[model samples]
Target: MKYTPHAYQRYAAQFILDHPAAAIFLDCGLGKTVITLTAIRELLHDSFAVRRVLIIAPLRVARDTWPSEIRKWDHLSDLTYAVAVGNTAKRLAALRQKAEITIINRENVDWLVKNNTFDFDMIIIDELSAFKSHRTRRFKALMKVRPMVSRIVGLTGTPSSNGLMDLWAEFRLLDMGKRLGRFLTHYRERYFLPDKRNAQMVFTYKPRPGAEEKIYEAIGDITISMKSGDYLELPKCLTNVVRVEMNERERRIYERLKKDMAAEIAGKEIDAMNAAALSGKLLQMAAGAVYDGEGQAVRLHDRKLDALEDLVESANGRPVLIAYWFRHDLERIRKRFPGARELRQEADIADWNAGKISIGLIHPASAGHGLNLQDGGSMLIWFSLTWSLELNQQTNARLWRQGQKHTVTIHYLVMKDSIDESVMAALSRKDKVQEALMAAVKAELGKE
Candidate 1:
């Protein structure tokens, strides 16, 4: 458990300590948690400059990730921390407990800042991109406490998941509107020209001439961005698709349902709400079940379940993290594999890391952030594909991140000629857009 950082991690720690108001635009799998934790440990013990510290992160991350990381390492193990989560009583009780570091979920930011009188000297915002929207209540609440916070650090992998317009609010939280601007309207008007394309549905923000370069130069002093491929020796990640094929009977049912747009199953009339709804039902059918209007999950053929059984059998004893889409899929999966454990609460995370759980089931949205699962497994099977690029990438990063000794393998279970194909296509388009955006920003930063 002795601590030894990679060269980039060491540089990141120093960067955080040196700049009071800064943003670490680090890629996934990089050790941002330990880097910031090391900086905070030194600030408290060595310089005696910081006393009370606060970390705002995702729900599960706040409850488990930060505290777990502190205990995992020897040098930072002595730092005391408490999780300010759960019901009102639990949160208040956690706040009352004497601790050097208080970690709270992002949802409770407004409540904690508004109700408490404590003036924290150091504040760390993990996954800063969560507050990209200027209109969110969490960002507004944090703005009220900015004057009292002495030092602030923002950390995120996809800083501009959407576009440059998202950075206005995040950077404002770090520098008190110095680099960006005091108001989002002014910031957009100054640097971005409005696009009337899809005006009713989407108002695009086009960057002003040389605006990207200008923005990068302005924030250059406080921000230190690092790419994962540039520093760490990342293990190769291999991707594979497990296609599920239906038998003659199942294919007849699927084709009839698709052709008629309505099918009766289990004495209930299952009707599509719209095109999107029809696609959803097809997706559900692909996964072996469909839900009716009365909130009933009608059972279908078990093609996907058979695929899962084969996958689990082939893996032998290696732990496999399975990401399911609907409640019915999970139920069917559990029935198929009686030993599979649900990735629901913090307690399950400990057992998973200890290799006690062989087959783990989790929804992508639940395990998408801050949980370190590299020690447990190297393969991820997507029982269903998600449309959101952020969730898909973040969930995969859990197993593919640093500390894993094996080349990560990701397998997607896709039903041919179904909505699964559409979901994969959508993700590809989104990935290209985000990659281009990141590349453009990186190019501008390199000019400096």
Candidate 2:
């Protein structure tokens, strides 16, 4: 197919091509892959500015996404590519093969940098946030070779998932710490205040007043930021919340556990040590199951599943992408809807895209990045809610982006008067901080 870029995509592609070291902070499903690929193609084939290109991405993405994109489009279809994954022999063989692009996972970055026999003029790191920690082996290894690459691009929608403290390592990879300072400690000292601390450990850090603005200004020249809504003429999205009420037996069990910090379920002693653990137990109860210390799942009630049944039935044959948080939930969902399939293979993606499958079950963390499901359906059901706003937004964008024919309708199943409500509030607060960087995500704090 001939490539046609939206105005924002055109700008993004040019921005990358013009800058030797750059970051594309584009929201999920906004065609960041195609944008970067087009820029690399121009430099490699048109301008003669670059020869070999190395693309470091998630494992599945390296194996599937870049190669798939090369095959799908007309202009990029001619580019030769190889996946440098698996055992040492396979990596060596791939490196020996003459190709314009080589894709490898982030885990093998250190291995590649250490045993590298050849040099790449261009490097693109997909999901740059993966290397936000300066102490990781991958980051350390990349630091050794950061100088050899002439053209570099750091790509991620959520650069600061936790807070601005995470940006130091990522931007350092792009400009050698020119914009974000040369060291993580220097960046932190200038813009952050330790929120919780003792003699040896800083538990949490908060941004100083006007720090976000100052940091944004520093990266304004090298980083190109674009949101999905700002670029794509997408269909309307209708987000609906479905709250589930537990039965008497379930309520008693939940309260006993919450009040006492422990309860007996299915003859097993269940307990939570802290607020985080307590939140987990509450989420499990809300999801109709709870796991003991021995990793046993105790079935609670069918309230959440009942809500899902209504959603799937009302879809009226339209495929539904369902997100689950636990293995027990997956098992139960399959038991209730026998035909629902976990997205386990490439063929499964094809089947969903063709609308041959009635429901595609996916864990948000697994299928959150670079998997195109927009053609599969216009509806998604969150059988379980996640506290991470990044996962929630990326998982939803799988179906809500450019190619859908109908208004996207997202269904959330929340157990009323449970930690489900609290989780939603926490996600909203987290979403607000991120929304300032990306345009589509708006926080709805207490709508529940």
Candidate 3:
């Protein structure tokens, strides 16, 4: 329980010590929470400059992270912590009371700012990407309080998911128009492609050479970026694709549904315009959902179910983390892998980690952030793939993390020659695209 700083944590603590107004861009499972806490503690102890530390994070993380980290480190026992969730009056009272640290979800930040709540010495924005959208009320409120805050730290695994524009909002909060300038649209125009061919007219950016270096020089001293692969001695991740050909019965049902959908939109000439919707319906059917008579989902293909069974059987008593995309997928997985625990069920995750349960079903979106399931399992089997690279990476980190004892092996069950292959390709290039976008932003700022 004592504050046994890991090597990566030590690096983070040192970075924070050197630059108090810094952001830690550490990977999801790289112990950013503990590092931030340690840094806050050190800052408080070293100088009488900092008093109360405010942590802004997602609801689940806000409710769980502070207390959990405090309990994990014995050295942090003296630090008092309070969460703002229930009874606004009570939470406000608790905030007014002298507490070393207070954590609140980002959703409530606007309300707190509007009410003129307690001022904080150090403010930490966990999962900072949530505030990437500059037009949001939360971003506007946080911007107003930027000048008042003494030290601001932004933490995120995917800082530039949407693009370079995401950094403007976070940087504005951090340094207040000092770093990355004031307007995102202006910044985009200065660096990105002028002409976008799409109907939406979305601009794309190509990072000029040396752009990353310049950005690093601008905020490099303040921001510490660390990847999990660089720190954790994680297990070898082996991605195996299990392609399931649609059975003749399921194929026939899928074709019928497609034909009916086409007929329904025939007068309207629903061609490529409605292709996405039509394809989605077909995919749903392929995944085991049948339109039957009404719009209700009915089971059709047991191939996916059979694949899951084979995976669970091969687990060899080790806990298996199953990533399911659709609700129908969840139902099929639950039915096929009986006694398999779902991540949302509090008792189930606890039991699974305690070695009482054999398998855990996790939806990528739900199980994506702030939960540490690595202690329980090192195996992840993706029953399906989504277009999101962030979700895929986050889900994989559930097992391939710092605290994990074993090497994590990721098995991806991809349907061959289907949309699955294209989705995976898109997922693979997303990170690279994000990196390019960030570099472009850095270049634009460098020119300024």
Candidate 4:
């Protein structure tokens, strides 16, 4: 098909062509893949600047999205690429092929760097947020060869999803520690104060006064951000909260577990080893079950399950997509709605998009990136809440993004007073911080 670029797409592609090191925080459905690919085509063939390019992305994306974009566009017909995934032999064979671009999943970055010579002159990280932790093996291995690459681009929708702390490692990879700093301890000391800490150990940190603006300014020069709302006429998105309450007996059991870290339900004993364990147990209980010492799920109440049943019935033959967080959530949901389908394999995704599945189930982590389900349905139900802002936003974008015809409605099943509420609150706070970061560096096409 002939490619016609939007004004913002033209600007984004030009931004990549101009800058050697850049970070583009593009919202979902903004055509980021095409933007980057257009620039790469120019660099590889037109300018003769970069001979070899590497694109590191999530597994499914590396396997499918990039190659599809290359094939879909008539302008990029000359670009040849090979995917370096699967086993060691397949990866090595792909690397040996005569291709201008090589695509590999993030999991194999360590192996690729350790076993082979670093040959790519330019590298693109499709989801730069994956390297938020400097201690990760992929981050460490890539850092070792950072200086060898002449050009680099970092792309993500949720750059500071967790907070400003995430930017340090991500920017370090893009600019070689020129923007944020060389080390994390220095970055933390300059911008953050310990929020949750003991005499010896600090558990969490909050930004110091004016630190957010300062940090944004530091990275503003090389970073450009754009939201989909500013560029696309998307369909309406509605978020509704369905609150469920427990009876006196169920409340007593939840309170016992919260206060003493141990409780009994259905003649099964459940105990939490620590605060983290207790939080998980409470979340499980809020969802109508808790895992006992034997790893067996003990039923606490069916409040959530009943609410879900109401939601599914209210759909009234319209397809419903459910996002679950726990293994037992899937089991219980499937048992209740026997017609529900889990969107796992390629066939399931194809079937869901074709309107063949009435109800589809997915986990937030699994559906976090690079899978498009907009053709399936517009309604998504959060059977369980997640603490990660990235997962929640990405999962919602699966249905709420561009090409979705109907108004997207997201339903959350929140227990009135439980860890479910806590998780929702945390995601909101983190989203606010991330929003500020993006707004501070929002892109203006003609000004710069």
Best by lDDT: 4
Higher-ranked by TM-score: 2 or 3 = 2
Which digits, one per residue and each the tens of the lDDT, describe model 4 over residues 123-199? 99999999999989999999999999999999999998898899999999999889789999999999999999889
Off by over 4 Å in 1: 162-165, 180-199, 203-220, 245-267, 270-286, 345-347, 436-448
Tens digits of per-residue lDDT for model 1 on 41-160? 999889988888999999988988888899999999779888999999999998888688999999999999788876688899998988988788899999888888788999887776
Local error of candidate 4 at residue 57 (angstroms) = 0.9
Evaluated against the true structure, the overall lDDT of model 2 is 0.86
Off by over 4 Å in 4: 446-448
CA lDDT for candidate 4: 0.93
What RMSD value applies to candidate 3? 5.3
Best by TM-score: 4
Residue-wise C-alpha lDDT for candidate 2, range 332-423, written one tens digit per residue: 99999999999978999999898888889999888988788988888999998788776788888888887877899998899999888987
What are the lDDT scores of the predictions, listed in order?
0.84, 0.86, 0.72, 0.93
- N/CA/C clash count, model 4: 0
Go through the candidates in order and give the C-alpha RMSD of each one to the true structure: 4.1, 4.4, 5.3, 1.6
Clashing pairs in 3: 1-74, 235-407
- Give Cα distance to truth, residue 408, candidate 4, Å: 0.7
